[model samples]
Target chain A: MSVTTPTGFRAAGVTAGLKASGRPDVALVVNDGPSHAAAAVFTANRVEAAPVTWSRVAVADGRLDAVILNSGGANACTGPEGFADTHATAEHVAGALGVSSGDVLVCSTGLIGERLDMPVLLGGVDAAVAALSDTGGPDAATAIMTTDTVAKEVLVEGDGWCIGGMAKGAGMLAPSLATMLVVLTTDAALTAPELERALREACRLSFDRLDSDGCMSTNDTVALLSSGAASAQVDEAQFTDALTRACRDLAMQLLADAEGSHHDITIEVVGAATEDDALSVGRAVARNNLFKCAVFGGDPNWGRILAAVGTTDAAFDPRTLDVSINGVQVCRAMGVGDDRSGVDLSGRTVHVLVELHAGSEAATVWTNDLTHDYVHENSAYST
Target chain B: MSVTTPTGFRAAGVTAGLKASGRPDVALVVNDGPSHAAAAVFTANRVEAAPVTWSRVAVADGRLDAVILNSGGANACTGPEGFADTHATAEHVAGALGVSSGDVLVCSTGLIGERLDMPVLLGGVDAAVAALSDTGGPDAATAIMTTDTVAKEVLVEGDGWCIGGMAKGAGMLAPSLATMLVVLTTDAALTAPELERALREACRLSFDRLDSDGCMSTNDTVALLSSGAASAQVDEAQFTDALTRACRDLAMQLLADAEGSHHDITIEVVGAATEDDALSVGRAVARNNLFKCAVFGGDPNWGRILAAVGTTDAAFDPRTLDVSINGVQVCRAMGVGDDRSGVDLSGRTVHVLVELHAGSEAATVWTNDLTHDYVHENSAYST
Candidate 1:
């Protein structure tokens, strides 16, 4: 799957020197003529980035021409200067593309409260505009990354429509839609309203459900743009299905790359009294740092998982709950899992499972193990 | 404030050779009283330790003769073997004290799913009984610790009544009350039913409010026993006041000893629309690892804090929220805290204040910084 496999969109990624490591820092995607219908989701964090503000204003008309993204300086908490920086970037992009400035969207991700060097950002925008081409998907994917080890790109080819997406985020990922900045491009002739509905539904099942580090970012944004360049007419269900699948793939990639993560765990809570209960239990485990650390240690500490589940309001009889670590049934009927013999946990990754035995509904959440690196990364710079 | 300061309660602590470090591992506390009123609370986590199982049952009647506690083996997830181990430990302690095993409460903390060595545990029990004396409080305090830098104890004197408590827990602390195992002694006479009411209330305000690492322990217990040696008649309010003060003091001590903690931060959400809203916002910050890490970095990244606050269900315009870091009012009406100049996060301990400006109600939660040692201690273990 690739993000630009959709019909009318053209994409490009280029370096702007935003990151000292000299990786690509600017990504530009454009709807080269046709329906520029668009919908965007911004971070729930009250501390928004400059780009979030600019994008929110651009979506006022429910139509968009392009998205310009940068990675490195978050351009957040820089006061009025950050706002001016965003406005300048979007205005420059829109002027060059001969579209309304309001039609140009922007996004940013990096260290919070840091200012972006305007000269580098402006030069990067110029390079991005010149480098824009229909098939430059890899470049676009590589541009919007701060600390991500690898770029994320997903493209879906449908009968009537095509969808392509690129996302950048590794840490500060959790529910509340995670800390990602994702852009979805489609060649289907869809309206802004329809795009909003489909995007929200797809996100609910994919991006919104991926809980990695349990911390939300101030610069989270997801934008969906339609190029209206497809030849066939794909139905709504087909489009949404393809969209969801693409998002799921990217979300999984992001989870795998979560910082300081030693384990890629998938917690499946089944037999819950309700789907809500299942999710509640799943989230409780996903957000538990201690439990995550235990997984990092390769310890099948199912007791920690059980404790996390019990802390939730979800209804269940502790004695009735069943737990399995890796495929070993270690807790049953609230008593204990049967297999405690010869348990080995000296592995890089581990899987833990819990069953409520209360009902038939189930849900799975993906997460990473907590490790010493995570603590070192978070604690070392105490100024 | 020390556990030994309480009236009419005898305690003994000794190293049982059960721990590889040769540290104190076993403790005994007895009430020489005219009343047998006792109350207790256990970990809300469904996966409880073996000692937790026995103590939970024994506390149902709210009347206990003695409490036997040990460190080094949590007796959790040992399957049926763990339960049998709990029974044997209780039986051994009972034999030494010449009391029914059911009259003794047991608590153990350390590694999960590890079986207790019966010989070492039994010998420790005998030593605890022989050394049980009111003056042995300090020994008992040292006997029940795992990763704790210092023992936690509190003493409070009220009119005709005294309250004293001791607790042990470094990690697995958060809502549902951090994983603290506490034992309280009182000289006031009360029924088991009354003691339960008071203890629950005290926990709600004290232990339950601290949201440290957000990990609930599998083996948490709080037992309160009355020695019935108060010199004069006392009112319920007087007894509760003293008990509450003691519990709060112990809770603070626990926070002070929180493993891998750089800051003992207090997040106060004021002017919320409701108590639940205030609490949700407060807890949202308490649980935000990025914000915690940012504070650790001394960046005064108030934006991350606001971003965390925005993700909650609490109602407030993002821009209208006011945030303060280290007593420096950083964000006003949803804007940047501007003077990032004076935001002092240099201290190992930090306090953050968030004003929602939605209502008059306020809520506070305590938590610690995200640090490397926490990860090291947790990740190095393999169960």
Candidate 2:
């Protein structure tokens, strides 16, 4: 259940003195391969972090030798000076690994608008490189955590190759990615283009559908590194399926540990005029603070669901909408249907289904219920 | 200061037994004048309340002899039966006033997806009409509250003419209107068309720009009635200005009494490419949960503001953006400027300024901080 579960990968995690808690804060993952093919997706937010800007160009040629990540300061909104810091960090890692700086990708997560401590961060990077081992995946996963309470890792085995992945993000989870950093390593015989296509499709279905708090981040990165050591030349469809499953697993782990969340909600929107309409309706409901709060209180308040759907321009007749909570059809034909008291919400997982009665297309989005702890955690997050 | 502050208007409030707490839940306002001209705006949500649909048509011809409002049930999402209830309510009011049913407007607020008790509501309406008085403005304001903590009323005096207004909404305040129900009255002489134009402009600059929680409601209405009793024949521009001032004053009251809020935040976006751009930017910041939480914690986290501004498509160079919390310029040129410690946010009101440096346009939006109490109130609201 770690990145080193795959062949041709070495990883390490070390303390960086950047965090006030004195925990491990720097990680390094290197692909030792006869084939170094890579693909990545960064935050769509225009005001991106310095590391995102640097890594986007590093992975553009579909190749990378190593990835260096730190968790303490996000290095975002720091202007040119911040960008220069990221460049220097990459250069330092490249020198330690004997690889070109252009082949090294960097990722950072933590409070935004602050610069990283260069001397301390550089010392940690040197220590991480020295401690690199094939079984260091779990350590690396633990190092890249900011608010995450647990380390998220997954492994998917194919015919002759396997994929290993790790993710770190607890808050600011939203569409177009959250404040997350995900790294996937695989020992499969796939080219750069194939890996890119598979990674994009997998992320679109997994991470893109999770909106914990509707807060987009400035430093979201998901990178896939392929080392063709298995020499299995697997089918593209099969590879894509395995990659998607791994991503979904990590996404669920993130949802389970979202900041101050009480319930994990899966909103399924069906019978829409189009898939986009279904997604639009689902996202609108998922982002509604009132609906989330209702779920947190263990109340089957289907009225708030319909009101949220009404705000979207999705194709749906107001009078024909139907809503079900946890298998209880609380609302039908836009009015009260079954007894809301029959619905059971005294659990951590909840399912909300909305039928638009427009068409056959459908989509689903995942979210977390708003709770008092959410407000408390976020209120003093930067302080 | 309320709807009855103006000449030729009488209002009353009475218990309807609609609320479980036995609070006054019915209100009536009568325009007893030689000229009855009115205009109104309803929520933009597609699945609007039954009363909104009824009042939209009743005020289409720019004439309203009376306005009836009720709390404890929104009368929304109840299908045809809900529409029938609103129609019957208008007819009852019309019968009491000896006027056409189309000349009476109805408004309802409270929980959605529930039917109102017609017998109890109608009895309260009769009592309210019989108890109508010239000094009943404060009582009428109190009667129309759902979760509001206090009555909101304002009066703006002009040249022998005055505009009086009242509003009630504690949560679900958003753009395109909130869960608010507002009533305005004026004795200034003006035509229906003129009243419509002025009311729209006044609402656009006042209530429309206040977004306390970013949750649009299905039952929002702002109605203005002119009795033309003072015979002032006021200037159109002056009347519009006074009306806007009254709306803004009531809006501030709503902001001050928002549900479970700790701080009232005013976000001002300047140097935008267009007025719409400024508004979009301001609304994005106002709606960001992280930024709202930062304000609640009294942490001057300006990076969250920049991250929110980056999410919008507004034309602005990311490198040139500036953000100020309270009066401290915490961020300049997209990077750290003044020390965040220099900023002060221990007050109940906060001012955030963002300069785009893209053009010469500006806009402002009002919101409230995200606090634990907000989550608590909303989570258990309908439970």
Candidate 3:
């Protein structure tokens, strides 16, 4: 139970026959709330999908009664007709729920540059509404998956309130956001501004730090809705902490299931002048193909790591830098230190620690190793 | 006859016993000139190799008497010992040629973070100096190779003068320069400043635009030396054009021989507000792993192209963008246009043209497709 784990929420998933594989492809979640408060973030990419444009405006007034999502064809780059299709999708869902269309949000994912099959989608939406239940969160999560091997869900229980979230993503993951769709629900007494603040802060420290492939997408959305059914006024700090935990849990799940990835690597950048500098340095190393390939081969080639770090303008003395793989310090002061053969990388998780010795600030970024399956999976994705 | 195609220059290649494969690993080139004028460029990566640090200062006075290059170990990330090794090699060369130690430049390639075998290297340097002759250019071209499959050579002839060049590189190729070692010789009567101007312009248009893997190296150098043996001065513009052609030719050769690459991709961005904008957009697409994978799989996934273009800050309207793969306009006005099936990517060379429709300026960036072999080669490279 993810989105529906919170009180006053109902969800459903149904088959739409939109996918060639004939998988369940449509989902709906509704909030019956004493307080209708919402916050959302979409892809920063300029070429946004039709549903992203539609939902962005829908949540501008800080209210959302429902969210509808689908996984079959990304309704992106389909022009004006695509936007119209998104509007029609929300309108159809609103008509079934007896709510205004302006209070509904929409999301779509899959292959880009294609139109959705509206008749089939509407038929599935009708079925989903009829099958809505408080235990439908698992099905909803599964329905929104493209290449994901498993569904992701999280539930954080407070004293009298709770936060629940579900997410779906597989590939094309990067910083600024991954190619993912996420929905969160909370049964707590909170205003829209409060929810927005917590959501932004949580996402910045969680999803924004995951750089699986260094490829941003055109249809990434994360949203949260609140219902005052719990009638408990929780502290803002508590809410933010729970939300961050949920997002990070889901992000790690996404990293584990990233397409064709063999290793989940965590790059911890310490001793920086600023958090931004640490992030910049971490991202540079995370995106370096040479470094990623070395990790995949389990080669402790610390020189590639230093070469990557040197590409950034972060505050660090090159001669004073240090790097460690796992628990072994392979490079000391930018030179070979301990024996590389002592460090083992034949595991699923790898840790790389970089000490800049610039200051006290630090940041961590998560990524995956480059592998043959990564190339094969992506190369044959659309085909 | 690449470097020796011009007059008043001698070069030689010798076995250094540095590489495990027993390949010729040492090369020497000297200017037996009436006028010795030189200009050189090194990698912009801040974590530079010891040879790069030494050569950059050696050519600062715009006069180079000789250059010594070695393969099998890049003296990088080896600390003060690496710098000392480079200095000792240059001094040895200077002693043998009866020139100032400061007038000799050094270059090294292969694996980083390792020390050179001084006794073996010094003996090979002696052999290289004694074996140096005007007809030794071919052997010199073959010596400074890391993973390169073929030697790169170019010769441009003028009315009374000629320019010749040779280069070696294969993987770890990217913008800001590839992991390459280059030597260019000219028999024309030119000054140091004029040669610098021409060399800069030539590199800016050619080597700078080739970004094979988006991984900048710690050691990349291109040096141009003028012997002034022909005693005939050519127009600066003409010399620049000839040098640009030679650089472009070598750059394309590098692209063709890039490790594990299946296709050579040319991303052309047109109708931008400025040339910089065009290049910015082109490089964005060139470095996008998703787009590169699509090309390797022979999939005309134009949506990935538009998605990559949207990530840039270049001047462009998202809705007005157009993309064509080969001769087929697969996307128009940022939507599906001609059928994607009409585009063919079965050939070795693939062209992707993007029309921003923001202005008239344009630029092109060259890259290689991501393939399984590329992953295989790089993953097991240092192992």
Candidate 4:
């Protein structure tokens, strides 16, 4: 169980013949609820996909009955025709589910500059609706993948209600939103505005700090749907906490399964004057390709770390900065500390700590190292 | 002939036993001038090298008699000991050349966070001064290389005056101050302010646009020395043009030799609302790891280019932007224009033109594709 782990949700995935690989390419999640409330966040990239445009308007009224996602085509940069395709797909979903077209959301992921195979995708929507089951969550998760080697799904149980989510991405990941497609569901009774606030706060700390490749996708979208079937009136704080936990779990899974990643890096920036400064400092180091490559090679290159930190306008004195890797203080007071050869980097998880000596604020950013496989995976062709 | 092409300049490079390879590790360039007017730029990185700290103050009065550079140790992040080494080296150079220590500029480039070997480096400084010759520019050029495959030296002839320079940098190259150590010599009659204006303008257009790996270095410095020995009165425009040409020549050489990169990419942004916007757009694309990897794999992935452009705040309508790779308009009006398969990437020189369709402003950025060799070179132990 994934999204359906939260009650009053039915999901399905079916082959649409949209991908050349003949894999399942379409998925649907229906909110069969006494209350249908939803909120969504989209990629800030000015070049948004056609489905993102349709879904943005659909979620504006804060009521969504169903979300239809296709994995074969991004439906981005396809001009007016692409928008029409997304509109038609949403209308088809609404007609099949006996709801208004505006109540249905649409999402797409794949190549950026191509139109969707509308006929196959629409037919697959019919099959997906017919196959919607409470236990179809696993298939739905698998349907959204492009370059991902594994499906990402998470469930966080509250006192009585639960939050669950599924995400798919591998490359084109950076800040503001690491490139990915995500869908979250909860059984707790809540309004659309509450869900919006909770989802925004959750994503800001979870998905927004993952800089895998420093590439932002044009079709990135994350949506949250809630149904009051459980009748569990959860507290606002509890709801946000559970939602954030689910999103973080899914985000960590995505990082672990990032394409061609050899090491998962956690960059922790402490002693910042503000949260934004900490985030900026962490993200700068996270996105530094040279630093990432050094981590991949198991080279404890702290100079690259400080160089990355120097590029940011974060509050910190360069001469007073300190760095520790895996609990070994490699750089102290902006100078050499421990012997680099003593630090062990043969594990999959690499932790880098930077002390700015500015204030009490701190933030952590997750990233992956640059490797030959990363180049090979990204440079082969468009997904 | 390189820096020695200009009159009133003597340069020498000698082995200092500081490098394990016993290669020439010390270099000295002296301005034997009636007018010792000079100007220089240092890395904007807050964590600057000890030599950058010393040279910045030495050139503050806009006059310098000599510059001493070493290649085996950067003398950066070594705290007080590193600063002490730089101070001692400068004093030794000033004593040998019979000039005040304040008139001697010092530069060091190699592994950061390590102090230079004082005895060997100072001895090489003495040997460098004894061996100074009018035609030793090539030797001085060879002495400053770290990871560079070849020495980079260029001379540009003005109406009556000539501008010559030598540059050394193969990695950690980025905007504002492309990571490198450069020495420029001109025998034209000019004041310190004239030399400063010309050098700044030249670097802004040339070196400032080369973003190799999106990593800034702690030891980047570019110095311009005017001896006023040619007795030639050159026009300001001619002098700036010649200086720009020389810098551009050395900048290109750095790109060509940029740490195992196979393709030299020139990203030109046209029809922007402002030059800064154009540069921002081009640099965003140049620094995108996904796009660079695609270029390295010989894949014509135009989607990666647009995705990078979308990340910037540059002025452009994503729906109206156009991209041409190697003269093939692969993306037009933000949609697929030509068959990506038609774009040939077999050559070493790759040209990507992005049209913002906003206004008349244009800018160009030179970069290299992310390759396996870049990973291998950077992942290995520090050179």
Indicate the docking level reached by candidate 4: medium
Strongest candidate by DockQ: 2
TM-score of each: 0.91, 0.99, 0.99, 0.98
Task: Write the residue-wise lDDT of candidate 2 on A87-173 in tens digits.
Answer: 999999999999999999999999988889999999999999999999999999999998899999999999999999999999989
Q: What's model 2's lDDT at B304?
A: 88
TM-score of chain B of 1: 0.96
Ranking of candidates on lDDT, top first: 2, 3, 4, 1
Clashes of each: 15, 0, 0, 0
Error of 3 at B161 (Å): 1.3
Expressed as tens digits, the lDDT of each residue in B1-383 for candidate 1 is: 55556677889999898889899999899887778689998877766777888898887877898898999888876667788888898888778877788888999888765678889989999988899887888889999988899988888887777788899988888766678779998888888888888898888778888888888888889899987887677677777777888888888888888878878898888998998898888888888887777766667777678778867888887656778887888777665556877977778667788887788998888888877767767765543
Off by over 4 Å in 4: none
Chain A only: give the TM-score of model 2.
0.99
Residue B268 lDDT in model 4? 99
lDDT of 1 by residue, A1-383 (tens): 44566767778899988888898999898888488899988777766777888889899789999888898878776667789999999899998889888999888888666678899999999998899887887888888876688888887778767788899888888776788889999888878888888888888888787888888777888888988887678677778888888889889888888876777888888999898999899999998887787777766666677778877888787667788877787777655556655345566445667888888888888888887766556543223
Candidate models: Cα lDDT each: 0.81, 0.93, 0.92, 0.90
Give the DockQ (2 decimals) of all models.
0.50, 0.81, 0.78, 0.72
- What residue runs in model 3 are displaced by over 4 Å at the alpha carbon? none
Tens digit of per-residue lDDT, candidate 3, span B87-205: 99999999999999898989999888778899999999999999999999999999998889898888988889999999998887877788799899999989999999999999989
Model 1 quality (TM-score): 0.91
Output DockQ, candidate 1.
0.50
